[model samples]
Target: MNHSATAMAFRASARRTLTLEQQAIGELIAKLDSSFDSACQELLACRGRIIVTGMGKSGHIARKMAATLASTGSPAFYVHPGEASHGDLGMITGDDVVVALSNSGETQEITGLMPLFKRLGARLISLTGRPGSTLARYSDVHVDVGVSREACPHDLAPTSSTTAALAMGDALALALLESRGFSAEDFALSHPGGTLGKRLLLRVRDLMHGDERLPCVPAGSPLREALLEMTRQGMGFTCVVDERGALVGVYTDGDLRRTLDQRGDFSLLRVDDVMTRGGKTVAPDTLAAEAVRLMEDSRISALAVVEDGKPIGALHMHDLLRSGVI
Candidate 1:
């Protein structure tokens, strides 16, 4: 084929696939009826974790749905239908909710276990393209994740159908999350190792250098002494405090450089003579993300942790970076 023809063919094929999948998902919006509500209700009322099962390509979508549900406060896990047939059926219990996915709703490995699920008295929820299929007929609630056609040119691959199923699963999970009033804090607890967890769960106190490690000096302390403290602490800044140990000013390396350029004599200078007064400070309980924002806004690299206007701790950019709080 000619180069122009090949480029045209690629664009045409990609556009066609995307258009088909978009319409498939659009069709799902109309299917959001009482059945979807019933499924969500059943899942919410479930006393135990949701058990999602499917076969083949549908199984892959089911696994992703299970992970999304688990992370979004729905509490779910996936079990392969083939495994369930081979002694994994014992995992399903009376208190659990079973969500079975199949594009045709006739996956033998899954349909074969219907009787055992019925015997166990577990609630059955089915996600299928065919509402009249056997799996739907046996389900307590059937969420129709039907799609008109596959994105595949031959209309054979599980492309649009899987996307619809995944979207439906996400819809259900987010609905449950909202109904339960699941806050960001609750979400962070489940994902303590994720970036959102680092932002929401990590606090200034957790990364701050406490009193012993803080580089602080009295207001009357000599500039040389403050610089030595800054060097000892290696934080690039030293906090200046009053008689009550309250934060009054701050002297950073930048301020020292500026002072040197503006003045020739520094040997007799005191902390108050060069310190910048009323510097930005943060409370220990402030979010590390908020601290980062403050530092970025002020164009500084460190902040003093204050309580009741008293300097109790201090921290630098490296501390936040080392703790994965940035």
Candidate 2:
């Protein structure tokens, strides 16, 4: 009961829990069998959405499993077994696959719905500790997510078992993701509001300033005129184009700084005299994230968006920053 004894006891308990959970996850690697494969094949063949259901602690894991499966391209959603017994059973159809999670494999709320799932002709994939239980017996594929013992000192809580189930769910989701050739772009489509989605889906056209907002100066225009355009547009840069409206070069704030460093007669100079020819440029359809990389590599803050040899728009590093591309 002393402070030292109490601290040692707490550390011992924490280590024991972590060790049990680690072993539980490690054991799952050897437990994977043909049943896991069959479960994946069934889920892949399902023409309708995947419906995941469970009860109590298993229900929490089922919701997360559904989310992972859905975000990874499996198209799944969680359904509470207790709710399924109500009007929610309408969510399940003949073409769907039902993934049920039950530590004991005999959760009454779920097993009670097995006949209805069968009647609806939906395939059942069960993750259970006891393969001989009713829920497993009724399943088309039963993946055993058993653990030797709970992390709890009394072995009364669903600790290590839930960890094993979670690991199994992740393994299933990633396997199917690879099997279907799901690309990062596909994942981005489902997560369009996240950083990855913005990086993958946002294009230069979506963020570029075009038309009147695109600052441009004609070749041979006075350097003073180009400076005015850059100030007016506030893009810190201006594109230099020929008489044909084709991009000839770019002039940036950096150029203005260098021009000032020269301390020459600015009134006599033309925009072409100080412009950076063949500057960094990107297509309108190019990803904004890729544009960021180009800017970083070229050590520039702005880029000319060119199409068919003509500058159509401009993009600044500030624009990318505001859009969360940085």
Best of the candidates, TM-score: 1
lDDT of candidate 1 over 1-326, digit per residue (tens): 99999999999999999899899889999989999899989999999889999898999999999999999898899999898888888888999999999989999998999999999999999999999999999999999999988999789999999999989988999999999999999999998998889989999999999867998999999999999999999888999999998899999988999989998899999989989997889999999999999999999999988999888899789988887877
lDDT of each: 0.92, 0.95
| Clashes within 3 Å, all models in order | 0, 0
> CA lDDT of 37 in candidate 2?
90
lDDT of 1: 0.92
Off by over 4 Å in 1: 2-5
lDDT of 2 by residue, 162-266 (tens): 999999999999999999999999999999988899999999999999999999989999999999999999998999999899999999999999998895778
Clashing pairs in 1: none
* Model 2: how far residue 282 lies from native, Å: 1.1
